[model samples]
Every structure is written in C-alpha cells, then in structure tokens.
Target: MGFPAGLLVLLSVGALPCQPITHGDSAKQDGHCFQVLPAEEGALNIGRHWGAATPAATVHIDMSKVTSTASSFEFRTLDPEGVIFFGDMGDHDWFVLGLRRGKAEMQINNIMTNISVRGGQRLDDGHWHRMLVMNEGDSVRLEVDDEELLALGHVSYPIIERPVPEMRLAMGGLLLPASHLLSPMNTAMDGCLRRWSWLNQTTTWREGAALRAKAKPCFSALRPGSFFPGAGLASFRPADLAGGTAPPNGSWGLEVELGIRAPRQTGLVLAVGVPDGSLALSLVLQPTAMVVRLGNWTKLRLPLPEGPCLDAPLRLRVSPTQLALQLGNHGGTLPNQPPDFQWLQGTWLGQEGRLFIGGLPDGDKTPRPQEWGAFRGCLRGIRVQGHQLDLDSALFRSDTIWAHSCPGAHEGAEAGRRARGHGAD
Candidate 1:
C-alpha cells in the first residue's frame, strides 16, 4: 500500500533516519536538523557564543529517544546541555536545562537569586518526547508534549551582568572544571537527541557549522539498549493462566531466582492471592532483611548478611509449611506462620486469583505506573509447581504487570528474536 501523504510529510519533516553528520559535512547548513549525542560519549560543540546573543528566546527539542534507567539522581539527559543559553565568566551566573531524577528541569542562577522548575512527568520510557522552553521578558514557561508545567515568573534581572571569554554551549553535557570531571554529578546522558533549536523564529541549526566533534561518538539508532533500572514487574490475571490451575490444597510451592538491585524501601517484590483481600503471600525486600507475609501476619524477617545482594543470586522457595531463602551457598528456612483468619488456611486456587512478580497486581489487567509498588533489578528464573516459565515470554505477553527483564541476560533467547524483527510477545 502507498504511504499516506500526511504521514509521509510528517516523517520527512521530523522523523529522519539516524544519519551521522561529520565535521566535513558543510560549513553551514539550515532548517529542521538534528545531531546525535552518543550514549555517555561525544557531544556537539555548537560554538561558544551560539545562544549568548539572545536572552528572550524559545527552545524546542525533539528528544528522539531518551534512555534514562533509574529514578535516583543518576540518569542525566543527552540533550542540549551546557550553558543552555547564557552565562557569565564567573560561571555562577547562567541558565541550564537537563534531566534530574528522570524528570526535566530548568534552572536559572545569577549573583542575586537561583530558581529552578521541574517537569511533572518522567521521560525515560524509551519513547520520543517533545519539549519546549520559552523565556519572554521576566517569565519562563516549560511544556512537555504540549502539557504545560508550572511557569516561573519575576525571574531575577541581569541574566548575565558581564560576558565571559569562552562561554561553552555543549549538547550532551556541561563544561565543568577538570577537578569536577569524575564526580558522580558529571555523568553524561545516555540516549539519542535531535531537532533542537533556540529562537522564536524556527530555523535549523546549520549542519556544517564548525560545531561538529573531532570524532563521532558511537550511535545505537535502535531503542535505548536496556531494561528500566528501577523497580517494576509483570502481573498475570486469573484468566491468563496457561498451566493447570494453581495447586488447590493451599500447599503449593514457588521458586524464584532474582537479584536485589536496591535496598527495599517498603515495597512488595512478589505477591499472589485473590483480589482486594488480605489472603495473600508476599515477598518483600527491606533495608535490613527479607520479609515474607501471609495474610496480615509476618511469617518471617530473615536478616541479610553484610554484603551486596548483587554479588550472588537470591533464591526463594515458599510453601504452606515452610519458607526458604538462599544466597549463593548460604541458606535459611523458617516454618510458615498462618494468619489468625481461617480463610487464609484454605486453598489459594479455585478462585479468581492473580500472580505478580516484581510487584503487586493492580485490580485491573493493565500495568500500573512505577510509583505503584514495583521491584527493581533482575529476575533470573521463576518456577511454580516445579514448572519453569519463561520470564521473557511472560513479560512480553502479560498485560497485568509493568516489569522489564535485563536485555543482557536474555541476549541468547528473546534478544535474538528481537534482532530478527520479532515483536516482544
């Protein structure tokens, strides 16, 4: 079938192929242009004085792809960073826009005052997002995908009192002093960026503008190549079950091989039981120990040894009579403590129940947001009733959970399928 006219036009204007522009491309080119910022490497040096010429400016960026991994203050943006617009020689007087804690933020600091505005939604979901920042007079407004964020007004005056000799305008990161280069705060963004412009009047950044880097950074035009680094998991509704029904005697067993990425902070890693009721078995990761809950009672709180959980695989085995926890060769077991309620002693099967790994199941089938309890890190294996299930297949096919598996771990299996153009499912 022929491509629709409107769709073709849109693709041509914005969604250009991942083509690299070298330093020899052109001395100056214009209109609807993009430059790739290699993950954690390379940046466009768009002239030291590019944006220093104007203060009342409008900036638009088509973040073609964002691969932020975690919600912590780590992941930074691979966008138009570094002296975003204007800054003084002292470096304390400047404005910059970038990502923090998975959200976009714009900060303006001068000799007199410092102000910052943060976006409402997180933008690390491996998708293209549009961002606009406009500074008119004393007000600055930020919009993400057309949604308006809180605007800043009465911004301090004298945006830049005096001009600096070498004002830097970097695309992937800021120009920091040599002493601060290795600091955790100095990490570069790890994603693709394109269609960035600064001005009320729309004009492409000149392609050949002596701003290209001496060596091009490696580019992965495909999706940000990894799983979500924070806590998240998949859910299986009662209707999605494929194996024989869950054991009906309330004496079933579950075995899961997972690695804890972060110390648990009041979160549920795996849960199985009926909907909206207290009758359930949950595995929780805590700061000091691993907790297991049956109904309203705490069955066990196994203390963790003094070492990183990532050093070895964690194996958990659960049944009505006992619970087992193992890290590498070390292991521990405790008798199951039933809740006071009689219903908890009955079979976990034969009802409209649900199963969740890496998170609790929401009432409906759709995946819940990350803010809704999710697990972090990797799940190496999961088995129920001695039947091993493919974690990758379940994750790609399930609708009730919001989990992601490590791409590196699944390289031999699903990753090969994905490279062969197979859908995740």
Candidate 2:
C-alpha cells in the first residue's frame, strides 16, 4: 500500500515529483528523476536510517570483479552540495564525486597525495547529467554527460589499493559516513540518481543479484514493521514524521496513533522531547489508562475500559481547540480550554523536535522519567498524519530493535547492561 501522506519526509528529498516506469513501457531507461531524501544528521555508528543510509538507493559492489576499473552514474538535480558518490579504504584514502557551487567536482585521495578537478559545465540546471570516472593507477579522466570535464592524478596517490571486498555503492550519499575525507558538502545529495555502475564488472549495480539483496529502492513505499521495545530506542525527526506544510494559520498539527501489543502492560508510547519545562510532551500506556502529559506537569488520563492486556489501537490527537484520545473501541474528546486542558494550547509539537518512541535510554546525564518506563511491548501500525515512521530511519536508536518479537528476561538484562555501559560512556 502507498504511504498515507505523512512520513514521506523520511522517504523523499526535495519536492521533486517521481515518474514510475512500467516494465513494458521502454520509453527510456534514463527518464524523469526520482526524488530522494537527504540523510538525517545522525551518528554514523549507532544510527541507521531505513531505505539505505544516504542516497536512499543502494547496491553492493564486488570489489574483486572491478578492482581496477572506473565508476559512472547519471543524475538529475538542482542541488550543488550533495555527494554524488563516495568510496574509501577505511582510512584517509578515498574517491568522491560531488558538486561544489553547482559545478561537478571529482576528488581522489590517498595517504600520500590527493587530486581534485572540476568540470566547467554548471550542472545544477534541473536537467539530467552523466558523470563518468575512469581511474587508472593515479591518473584519472572525469566526464559529464559524455563530455570530458577534467582529468588529474598524482603518482603517489592510489584511490583504493585494496578496496573493501564488498562496498555499498550509493547514489548521492554514502551508506555510512565511512570516511574522514568526506567534506561537509559530501552530505546527502538532494536529487535523483540512476544508472550507477562500479566495482562489479558483469552488470550494473541494480541488476546484480547478490549485491541487490542489501540495497533498498527508497523509503517512500509503505510497509509496516512492529517496534518490540527492549533495550532499544527509536526516534524520527519531527519534520519527517509530520509530513505536512503548516496550515495558513502558521500552526502545525500534531497527532500520534499506535497499535499496541505487550507482555508487560506499562510503556512510554512516545515522548516528543525531553520531559522538561513547557516543551515536555509525551504519551504513555498504563494498566488502567493512557496518560497524555503536556508541558511540565499537566496531564489528561484516557482511561481504558479494560486493563492493559491491550492488543488494539490507541490514538491521541491535539489541536488548538480540542483534544481527543482513543483506545481500542473506546475514547473521548474534550475542549482545549480552562481547568483541565489549558496545557494543550501550546504549539510545541513541531518546535519540540525529535519524537522518541519505544525505549528511552536512561543515563546519568539524561535520566528519563521513571513513569516513562521502557515500552516492553510491540508498537505497530504507528501513524502520524496518516504516515508511519520508519523504524530503520530513526535518527538515533539503541541497538537490537527487534521486529515481530519481544525481548525476554535475558534480553532485558542484557539491555540493562548495555544501557549502563552506554550511560557510563
């Protein structure tokens, strides 16, 4: 099924439209560019976003096949700062394709010397462009759309003497920030990428069978995964999770809905930001009710008809005038005025930032609310503005976020150990 309008932020880059092609309609391989989202600014090691880390589209490279060959790809974009591609040797040696001030740039570096050359053609003109790089033992030839952009190389610099046996080749970003040589402009490319080829000699990156296993097409497509909380944490950028322009009133709406399944009945369904001050906001599930906390201490308890043996849906919606909460088949709506809900008037959803879901790690530096206990349950079919947050696209998360299964006592203890260690660090 298609994504329900929201969460497309994690799926899409700029607002460029995509033209999906049919198998029989061989109009052209290189057609309208598919929009891609930039990689969320996150730690490369502990953070992994869904749908490939950077360029969104990814394919593996069998380094042994094209150990000594060139790389090429076609792209269409108006962004000038995203990396077209990056490959490195786990150190200072690497090769990169990028745009600097709208001009195509190619750089290759090693422990010894580095070479960089730019193309005269300005390519950020909202049109398709092809980049070809042929590296031959230091000397290189770079081209754009079949025309030679520039060529340069150094005697001591060899891009990757022994490249990683398998490397994920991406469109406009690296699978991970695996290089110190990557410049700030080497960030996620805000454009479309296609026809990527390298490392493997037999077929293109898309057509390769073994390599294709690890790559994802994009995050725009919809697929539901369950969040079984344990020692793990998951979060999404507020902008991406609530994928909508602010209404003419200049106020963004915030709504959170979730499906609950749990062995333990207590859990923090979500926390918008740290639970402090007027910015603190969170949703929590208890044995008897679902608690909605707004700002420092104001709370509205949505009591459930049955105890928390919940295997049903729960939704909470907040607006300038009213608040609504639902559990399974029972729920209520209240006006956002006066005595009980004056706390609801603050428009802090979008401004509050990251939405922390499931398990929120507790450390000495960032001790979470004790009532905001780890969600020892599975949260599924999560929807915000009809869109579902991608578990894989979390900006920062705890390790071992399992899908389809809940962690047991042993796992929980392990998680505690890990959290303690993380807190220590």
Listed per model in order, the count of residue pairs whose N, CA or C atoms clash below 3 Å is 7, 5
TM-score of each: 0.39, 0.43
RMSD of each: 19.6, 16.3
Tens digits of per-residue lDDT for model 2, 1-425:
10000000111112122322112222121111111112112101111122233553444455465444456655544444456666554445456667776687765555656656666877655444566666555466677778877766452333345445644444555644534443444354444454444533433434234323322222121112343434557776665554633556766456777777553356777876543332356777776777877655456787765432456788888765666788888887766544323333333334545577876655643445665566655566677777765454457655445332121122221221221110000
TM-score for candidate 1: 0.39
Residue 266 error for model 2, in Å?
Answer: 2.2
Predicted candidate 2, C-alpha RMSD: 16.3
Worst 10 residues of 2 by lDDT: 1-10
Q: What's the distance in Å from true for residue 29, model 1?
A: 43
Ten contiguous residues with the weakest lDDT in model 1: 2-11
The model with the greatest lDDT is 2
What's the lDDT for candidate 2? 0.49
Name the Cα RMSD for model 1.
Answer: 19.6
